[model samples]
Target: MKSDMAQEEDEPSGAVLDQPQEISFRRALLDRISPLISSTYTLRPFPSKWQVIRHKLEQLRSYLAAAGDSPSDSQLMELLQSVTYTAAEAQALASRCADESYTGGKLLLRSNLDVVSAKLDFHLKRLEEFYAAGILTLARAIVVSRPPAGASREDMRFYVKDLVSRVKIGDSQLRLRALGALNEALLEDEKYARILSMEVANGVASLVTLLESESRDVQEEAARAVDSVARFDSHKAALVTAGAVAPLIRLLEKPGTSMEAKERAARALKKLTENSDNAWSVSAHGGVPTLLSICSEESGTSELVHAACGVLRSLSGVEEIKRYMVEKGAVVVFVKLAGAREEAAQVQGIELLLRVACDDEQSTAVREGVLRALVRVLDTGSPKAKEMALRAIENLCAASPSVAMLDHLVVSGFLDRALLLLRGGEVCVQEAVLKAVSRLGGMSEVVKKAMGDSGFIPELVRLLEVRSLQVREMAAETLAGMISVHKNRKRFVKEEENLNRLLRLLNPEEKSATKKFLVAALVILTDSTSVRRRIAASGYINHLEKLAETDVTDAKKVIKKLSSANRFRSLLTGIWNS
Candidate 1:
């Protein structure tokens, strides 16, 4: 075999080597450096310096050996050449340091040793740079395989790193395969996701770039991988920081994108934005309008629409983005979704509508379908859906402050649906319906009469004893609003049970704000002399007398009304007896 120096001279300088040639050159260089580091040097500084250089060279050798079949480019070839040259210099220095009788002084020999050590350190750092830069390995066109069953942690780590390397540098076909593998791995074990997250540059960033791939398959696979990784809260910030939002939004806004791709992209976004800090990226990239458009599409797949709505729901938690979505007609889109035949779509629509309902009134002039859709949702939606739907209706009523809207809702049968939910719905749903009923009750005497005639008064009284303090307060307020109508008042007093429930809630021991509304209702009930006598005769009158001393809302007024009626009744009785 030719000597190492002759082999080095035979190779052309600054030329890109084929894979075999590069491998041979690296092997030869490693062979030449090994004996130099292994041989002992007698001098003091030389021994320690060779030890440091030996450690660095050993690390480089292991890196190259393990990085099997990684294709070489000009930059890597140049780095290898520099390492080879530095190894030669180290050998020469080693030979001189071994000769104790040499005329070269200790200072000169030590300085040379220092120079050689520094050069080796620089080369090692460059090797690390190549690794971190994600160009250390350019995978062949062959597909990457997943780790074997029951693989060791280090083995699994190697498999993930190999796949990530392929994703970073492989062709379109290889990248798609690698992304699919990565998605599978991440889903199969969360440990793989944690590993990927640790690879900041070669990992999430490579996947984010694939989001804009010209091929839909590649883009979809990339999005699916991102979706899997994003499922882990620890991985979400990595994805967001890698700039995943803008390209995903592009997929949603892009016209020719497949429904599958859009759904994957939307799902990824939904997971990513679950962290509120990542929400601004969506708004910053015009994602609000794109998401709204997806929701508005009549032909969008249910999954696509649902995922888009989910992202919108997360974005709405950010106040600025919520306003932007409203500006882009998100309310109308969601309102239409609320009316969709699919219960899932209706639920999502109602949820998003609840977020933007206050701003929805601005467009209600053109939204003739909102009330009917909401009423439909209230009728057939799940309990949570019904709660959101009712709350949305209450928001609309409060926003517009219009009697015509309330009349239209009543005409569309809102009152009946609300009463049905109030009587039998879940506690959350009951609270929401009570809010809507309270808003409608305060609107006009006609609404109050309609509500009372629908038998809402008894239900409101029964709710006074519910476990939820908020529900009791809402019920009292609604009953108070309706009690101004004579028929509603009569409906309230017609059941002695109703008066007792109200008075029990108004007891001095009660600490809730519901007493204010109860006092107001009783003050109205004083309009009837018989009702007044019944209230004065109830055992809870002393509770009101104590409440009046504290000056609770309208508590003093209730006391004055009862006291005046009693004085008048006493005088009449005395006159008749005399």
Candidate 2:
């Protein structure tokens, strides 16, 4: 009877205590956030992860009871969050969020007021919706709240680090986004100087190690993230010391990765050693010789060549690096890329060779040798390479004037080969040869006549109607050069419609090179007094003046040069004498 009476007495008070009041879940969780955010700020006695989860469950049960038999809408949401994060790092989270002032007597937490106060829909149904999508707001919630000194050697740091590691690589986009966030937070100059942490370095190393992952995006992000982390000298040295260069170079050999990734890595490598031992290490790792082999491949990979050239370009700038490049067969590589059929490869290859060749004898040999090869390449390569090679030759000629290069190619019958191929070759190669011939400085009238005799005008005219911008540029340039020489100059003006077709491309519809070519061709029409009279008589000069007024062709230079007494006398003096 006494036990029953005591139980009856306790039941009344228990019922009153169990009759939950309406406490908001946000108020409870947000109130605790300061301690949570600050919890990992210092090393602490970490509870077992399960203990943290169990403590959080107890807190949720009590908080839910206080709100009512069930939680208020806000309290319910906090309870669900507790479930997600308690198993993650509950006590450390609370401690990280808590203020230093709280240790004396209070348990107040520092909330990321921005996150806490933001009105979020945390209903179970909405939470589940986000959870199903793997976008639990709490997971995103922890990102911004992280202390700027994000990684440390403490146990909580290890635990949090493990959490990130446990995040599956299956979600590439999310993983990349997470990497961005981590880089933004942990990769800081201050972090490097004062924080006394290699944790960031470890994180970066993990990212760089992913370069070998079969996943292209992972390799890309890994390279990008590695580039970002290499801002510090020590980290850069560590990465180089750790043999990261070879793997990055190997990734460049992968044909599938984006050019952006390859270039980014190339640039990073250049920056890392800043002309130190890493440049030579690239070769020691078989990087240079491998790059040389890649350059020799003619499979039409423009982007890959550009990327490979970028690595070479950087290596060519410093004396020590340049020497390393030379020793590693860079000369042979550039010589080959200069002769490649891909436009970008030829363009960048020439640019790369120009840099390497601009200074010393060895460099000059590579540059001149490549130039000689390109002269022949202009005859034999695909239309794209021929055009690109011509442009590159213009640049190369400015850097290293070598007519012997062209003379040799000519002696080898390269001009005839190019012209022969033009008539039967793809309109591209035909056009390329024409543009190339325009720039082929040391040419004889016999060669020019051979080109004109190859039925080049009709084919060029046919190509003028072709839609390719580069093709038209090449055709226009070829016709211009053909008209500049005495033997073929008359052939151009005799084709009445040729003037009209060249004029259209000479208009605003054309590219700059096309206009230059048209202007060159137009200047031929007024070469002599009789030709000028015929031009003046046939309305061709007036048409040119109108075109001069059109301004698209920059023909004023040609008109001004042609009409001047000096220019007229100089021109009608012989070449345009017809």
Tens digits of lDDT, candidate 1, 259-318 = 888888999899888888888888889888888888898878999988988888999887
TM-score of each: 0.66, 0.46
TM-score of 2: 0.46
lDDT of 1 at 574: 100
lDDT for position 274 in model 2: 65
Clashing residue pairs for model 1 = none
Best-matching candidate per lDDT: 1
Q: Count backbone overlaps in model 2.
A: 22
